[model samples]
Target: MVDRKLFAGHAVRRMRRRAGLTQAAMAEALGVSASYLNLIERNQRPLTAGLMLRLAEVYDFDARTLSAGEPGGGADAIRRRLADPIFADLEIDRAELEEWLSGAPGGAEAFARAYDRGGAGTAASDAPDPGTVVRREIERWRNHFADLDTAAEGLADELRQQAGDLFGAMAERLRVKHQLSIRILPLEVLPDVRVRLDLHARQLQLSETLDPPSRVFALARQLALLEARGEIDALVRGGAFTDRAAERLYRRHLTGYYAAAVMMPYARFLRACEATGYDLELIRRRFGASAEQVAHRLTTLSRVGARGLPFLMLRTDRAGQVSKRFAGASGSPLVEGPGLCPLLDTFAVFQRPDERIVQLVELEDGSRWFTSSRCVGPAGGWSGAVRARFAVTLGLAAEAAGVLAAARGLDLTGGATPIGAGCRACTRADCPQRSAPPAGRTLLLNDRETGVSPFGFAGD
Candidate 1:
């Protein structure tokens, strides 16, 4: 087999510009001629192993940065975006996409942004969904904010929480520092509201209906708004959100992240995670947090140098409507798009309420994931009214299953249920649970014979 050449011209040029080095200066540092360096920077020449070693030695460069434009990275994102049905007629090949991504990454990113904004020709009245924009931004960062984690760790230390009584500590801090009194009002008084902050009265009112863990989360959210406002605002401003609604929504999300970080405090939580083998129930009890909160926090353990398992989380209601999703470092396509495979245990857990379901499933591409799903809260309220209940699923790559308690004593290789991203993106012809036909395929209507799948399509 021949060795593949490394061509990261854009990254090399960016690094040089960021270092404020002239072509000749950088070339001399890398022990290469200026003309050769220029050729490498222009993609006319590929960087050899020796040059790459020199780059690492001189600039402390990470070789993996060169793979950003490769198939499974940024180029993959462009490919997935172009896979949308709207671009079906374009028939843009991989070679063209790789060339575009390497040649003008900014233009490629702009194209992605346009696609995210519901296409370039979207009318003024047809504003892009604010929630979609915020979700994309969160996914772009892989739901991890290092600065927020640091600030929250500091705040958690300052709180001096004892026996994991974070709610009490936070309430005391609000009373002492912010001059905000905490009051638990009866459900009859605050029937519909769970938390109400009266600025004029200098009081934070929480409904008695909220469970202990939820109460702590609510208090932490309030404290985050008061204490981490600057950090949250900085993150929101950095988002460059054109829609004020999206900006506000993103601000709320950042505050929630900060709140979780404060409650779980990165170092302590990571230690607990490692020690417990990521047992969600045990960790929730230890931290005085809800199952959903624990699962969500698991996704945010993406700190540099000291990272935990790269987990992806998804929360959905009985109707299969997804309410929350975080892709984390794993970047599973299952968490992306509107559709989810009905066959995944995420939906099956709803059948067995309050019980944790662990399943090893293989996607269409043969990638396997170990998933744990359980039903989360529907906070107490008037008995006559409807309450919301959701199932939360936390999953990681199956290769790392050995590290998780949930995957213990399970067959990792065999007995893996074959799954797909969703009905539209899936090509599983024999899947009986398919709710819709795969996209870009002609429906096969056989009057005489019926297949296992209700909607048979003509394809491979």
Candidate 2:
């Protein structure tokens, strides 16, 4: 009889809200008194295992969320980062900052990005923004969502026990508890969609063209959403999103995380990562996930005590627009300051799609990074007629490169390309591809003297 002593209070409230239930309504669904649910939400009383399961059985929630713990994200993480003297004048609290983070994570991240770059404002358009803050919130304690991974693994176990029909098991759960019917539609009307839920019709529609892994993942995501809705909602509502667009964007991000986790259960996936030395192709084939998905999931493997390699992920388009980024690793993390470094092979791979490009990048301050960059075209079942394309770069600190299989045969020594966030902050005096002079630097020009570098700063 595990009491909800470990229950996430905010999460319970959020689940109730997402279900559009009153305290009385939610309590009734959970087979508990309205006062008891009220107490649970207020941390005045803990829910028993019976009530927890009842909530899940009724609402399709993953039970792991109940044990994930309390939410106080923005206050502590933001405070530590802002401890610098530059922001000593401002005072922020757990409740106040949490409210702000919930409502406008992008703005909060914009502030953190500016601070991380030691700048007055965000100079690079693609640098960490409020949207990033929203996504990073879940990523910060990614293991909390590892419960979804465990649930996925549980379903996998059930498949073995029931002899290989997890979808049937899941569909039966939907039908019995949720009164929902499942349909696999052809890619004609669903050409651009992945999963469509018709709550009014109590129907779930998925694309027939979805690969086996994707089809299972879509089913898992739907189940995870129903069972884990409270978990996702709690994380989303805790940020207190003021902007509807940012809220919806982050909600989708959280949902996709559940989908990926369900597809590649964390523990099972970690075993594969170790056996494969974090090789993207092998992991993709083994899990039936895409290379891009495998790469993105690599960044989320930082669960405590069960941590894997500290790999950070970044993706950018041909036009130099950074679409996705995660810098969860600690040591010399991928900084967010300037525009695209024209010299880094990360951008060049756009032309050489199939080629594997490895890089040794050194900053002006002498820290180094090891990275493998490759161009990945959009996968099938993406709504558009023409799938989009982007280059994904997986990188690690230079000292930590020893843990990665991709770093083999490469000179871990010198001859590294000296790069900066962009021309605005770059101090390199001799670069052929300087886009703009570094900020606060006076462009050096003498009538008789011409330097090879387009705009050599006076200091440089």
Clashes per model (N, Cα, C within 3 A): 0, 17
Off by over 4 Å in 2: 1-130, 135-156, 163-179, 208-213, 330-335, 381-384
Candidate 2 lDDT trough over 10 residues, lowest sum: 1-10
TM-scores for all candidates: the values are 0.85, 0.68
TM-score of 2: 0.68
lDDT of 1 by residue, 107-202 (tens): 876876776666668885674688877876776566778778989899899887443467778888888889999999998899889899999999
lDDT of 1 at 380: 62
Q: What does the lDDT read for residue 373 in candidate 2?
A: 91
- Candidate 1 lDDT at 134 equals 84
